[model samples]
Target: MRNKSRKIYSMLFLLLFLWGVLWEAESVYAANWGSVELTAEEAVLMDADTGAVLFEKNAEEKGYPASITKVLTALVVLEHTSPDEQVSFSHDAVYNVDRGSSNAQIEAGDVLTVNDCLHALLLKSANEAANALAEHVAGSREAFAEMMNEKAKELGCTGSHFQNPSGLFSEEQYTTAKDMGLIAIAAFHNEEFMKIEKDLRYTLSGLQRLPEGNILYMEHKMMLPESRFYDSRVVAGKTGYTRDSGNTLLTLAKEGDRRLVTVVLKDKSPYHYSDTSAMLNLGFQETEKQSLEDAEGFLEKIRAELVEKGTLTEETKLHFSSKVMLTLPKGETQEGISYLLLEEEAEKKEISAAEAKASDSGMPDAKDSALPHIVFLLDGRKVGEANLYREQNIRVMLSEASPKTKAAFFAVTISGFTIMIAIAVFLFGGGALYGAKNFADERKRRKKWKDRRKKRLEEMKISEEEFRILLEKRKKEKKN
Candidate 1:
């Protein structure tokens, strides 16, 4: 009987422990599970300022980014060149549909400013624009790719490696949702980048003519009116889709003082737009709740501490009076009750006397003269009252420049001009003008040689009969 009782007690204890463990597990699952449904392979919502992860779901999983890789491409271009700088397309930028997957319609010889190219790349997901901008910035796509990797390291994007400026498919070129979010946050800070990504409709001026002679227009995919996730607060974002990576989105949203960075990658569901929208909404709501809870706790602590100390006294009251009981005329001054002590009368009298004397003397109050007095003190002495008016016009002369200073300034200016001239000659004269001249000379030489051959033919004046006889004689000599 004793052994059976001991066995029953042990079983009851074991059951209770298992139940407790199960309960805790369920509680944890409940805390994490929200109303929003997420289909992304990897997703993250992060604080832009602190880089704090508010929520994450498989955020470290690697996935294809598709055209979203152009975000890094845009970042590299913006770092290297200004927006207004012109970029001319090359043969490399020509989209050849036969050569794998090429999306952009940009062709060789088309010209666009770097700013405009960036717009097409980010908003329209133009692969040709991405390549053109990359080549323009770093002289080659490979070098630009190296720069992108270097920048990734600098930005602490450990999970990303860029093989191309255009996010073409390669197993080696992959990034986690968290790393993409970080990159998006960094890119969003630049005004030019933000402008291009958020712009719904951008008319690219110089897309190459099609076979049909019609010009092509690049349109923003994310800015489509039919997109359910569209919000004015979304300053910038990139959207990407591929067979491997279903759909990916990186968005920056600002509402009031709150800024959110959201990244969703490899979503398997058909309603990607709605899924992202719900996730972002839930993230914002959760963050707000957390912030309010923190604020309330802090305020409660402060209130408690203040009440415990003498800082907040019960008699320190707010009196309320009805408007009807108060016979106050609009714009009329009323003298309220003044609290004073008899012991402080002398000090008050002195202050009032000084103020009255200033008023009677038609002089500005002491407070008005505070800045001037401070300036005078800074200058090591007070200027006379009359000189106060002149102080506005008085410019403090800097001491005479030393001989070394004069020499340095002259040297710097001369060197600046020298560098400027060298750059102008190398860029304009050596590259364009010299090439043009060389081409012209070659053409002239070719033309002259052709003229000489024609003159020789005319001088020879060989008739058709003579030419036929010479050809027969040559054929007979070869047979012998």
Candidate 2:
């Protein structure tokens, strides 16, 4: 009984050790930002290209967006109407928002272009502008809200829901930092949307009928240089404030060639630009680390391939041998040499001829002998083939190209052409030779046309009197 008890305790201790190791591993790789100095309830930093999370503080926690909700509102409006289309403000637009909501000073019956309204909505964070844009798009705010929810689903924002054009704080109206990051990414891609978010100041045209008839002007709340940490990297951002979502900010910044999106919600202070700045700094640092790791991984893959090919000894020691200077995208995978064996003997010439046939047949022979045949398979289907040494080179080439190239060369060449032409010519001819032949043929045809045109111009160069006398002499000779 005592021995059994000892075994149980030993097993328990082993499990605890494994658990500790797993915990440490997760802490190293996990996105969770623990105990940050910022007072935000939820925040996130994500890569604009792959939407991979670089850092997070309660990123999944639900919160409000306030005027940032207008990002989606603008998306819906842009989808329904062109920028130059005019939309008149109705009483519904003026009063549909919460009683104390921020206004663009848009009075009922006011006329403004959709583009101007979007500028007010995005740059000014004007609740009235959101309402006017929504009503114009779908004939009412209720229908526009439906469209917003649908778009959110399409964008894979599962943690968000919309109940109003302007975020007026309802239990039903809530979004997480992760969801908001996605919305910001989608909004940033639109040219006009980026323009509004980045603008520091905007001036509205004077109302035609108002007695005061003064131009309305507003400045970005988060653009104050002295407010907190200033980053020229932050090209565009949206600031939102309410009793529920205190001092929220969504910012877009570019560093070198990469773009980053950050979101912070429900901060303790009314102005949380400092928190935003801190988050942006953290994001840039994390992104740099990830980029470095990616470059190292690519170099290591090349080194491994070299080792496999016997070019470098596996145990060879060299400082900085695994250093790479290129940036590879996230989730990038390197190609590795794969081998196959044929069940029956086949000639090398037959194997070469079988390239097209093997692809169509979907079964390839893999042989392990002198001049061994190698077939390329993607997702278990044979794509192409080569001899042993050539195959190894192809594998290395594919690995290097995969980081920078997508859709394969054949797909790209065939995409722009008509289906019949692409299939008959590009697919049959394969790579460079087919392209060269077509180019040369076109040049020859053009040259022929040029020569014909030159000859016609030379014939027409005769004087009008000389041409008439020659024509009369030819006619008299024919009569005789």
Candidate 3:
């Protein structure tokens, strides 16, 4: 009876322990799951300052980007034409848009300033305004579209293409949340763009088209001060919709110093705002920003190396052309961040013998002094990059000259039998060290040359075998 009781107790203890372990495992699984549930089919939460993705779901999936096209349209227009530039509406610009679609009702031959057009474009969601602005900037809608596509490519948008300036329904026109995010980030950098986006209302008083002042109210419901969904953190945003494309929104908001850009596409009514709010909250709760310049010790170490190598001098003014921002989870240390300094390829130019001599004598041409890019990675994924520049010219300093040159100078100064014997021993004994150093340097030089050759071949769209044959032929010609 006693043995049976003890066995029963042991069984109970083991079962309880097993149940506790299972419960803990379930808790951990729940913790790993994302904190927010969104209704959008494609969405992304990005750090506005750093361009770092905080959360994403099907961000690369292409979908119709209705009025959001105007955001890019406005950006491109602002890049080419000033805000005060006069825009004349043509018959095509006014009548090309669908009659039932939102329009500013400007007649052909009527004119308005670019600033007024942008107000109508953004606030009233006017299709005619977009068309008029496009024509004014590029002389024709087709050429303006080419500029848009080029701008998209420059912004690293691979999954997006623009067939028209306005976000009208087109089979070929589509964009992804990821691509729009990049475009929005670039646009936000423009002060005039943000200023236009942040307006609650815009009234165009002196228009050449309209006799009475046109009062335009904000079209974005969530951005309205009286709306229940209105968030004070929201700085600027754009909204879009079409029959084929469901409601889409690209919004920028800031909480404290942490700014977030949210893109939600193909979402049901009101859900885009709800989904964006949830994601923005999660981003603020989970992430913190760290400036790359704060890595003082790390930067000092690099600066010391640059100074020792004669790449820079103490008197040389180092002005960082770019500033890096790292966004990471709150409470997580910066141990995961890594950096790589990559020099940009300088343009190769042919110079006369006199010019070459001048270049070799501590006076490098502009083509010879390309700046370097500092790339930052978090958890092995690229987070951000910045350029490093120096105001002073690059040259070797006397104090930091290579040891071999100093030794050669010393050998030349001492000329005698004993000195000759010393030199012979030095040459033979130092051969091993010298050979190893030269081998390492040669490998670096070869790698750089190979990289340049590979880049050239890629640009020319040539095969490796063809490039090799061409290189050998050039070498033979040079030898001759």
Give the top-scoring candidate (lDDT): 3
RMSD of each: 30.8, 18.0, 22.3
Off by over 4 Å in 2: 1-35, 206-220, 224-229, 289-480
Instruction: Rank all candidate structures by their TM-score, best first, as comma-separated numbers.
Output: 3, 2, 1
Better of 1 and 3 by lDDT: 3
- lDDT measured at residue 79 in model 2 versus the true structure, 0 to 100: 78
Candidate 1 local lDDT, 1-480, one digit each (tens): 999999999999999999999999875542232345687778877656445455678888888887778888888888899989998888877562226553556679988888778877876677888888888998888899999998876665878889889887779789998888879878867777877665566666656664433232323233455654456566677777777877877777776766777888888544555666666676566544111113234334433443465333332221111111111112212222111112233234345545665333533232222211001110111111111111221111111223454556668889999999988887687667777888999999999997986777678997556767988999999999
lDDT of each: 0.63, 0.66, 0.78
- All candidates: TM-score: 0.53, 0.56, 0.66
Q: Which wins on lDDT, candidate 1 or candidate 2?
A: 2
Q: Which stretches in model 1 have alpha-carbon errors above 4 Å?
A: 1-35, 96-104, 207-222, 226-229, 289-480
Tens digit of per-residue lDDT, candidate 3, span 1-480: 999999999999999999999999875532121357889999988887877777888999988999988889988998998888888889899999876998875778887899989988988888989999988988888899999998897776889989889899898899999999988888778788888887779886655566687788887776888998888888888889888889999888878877788899898889988998898888888777877745555565556666786656776555556556777767656665777665432121212322554433543334324444566766554456665665553243323334554555456666666788877877779866887899999999999999998998899999999988999999999999
Among all windows of 10 consecutive residues in model 2, the one with the lowest summed lDDT is 320-329
Q: Model 3 — which ten-residue stretch has the worst lDDT?
A: 345-354
Clashing pairs in 2: 340-366, 341-366, 342-366
Error of 3 at 63 (Å): 2.1
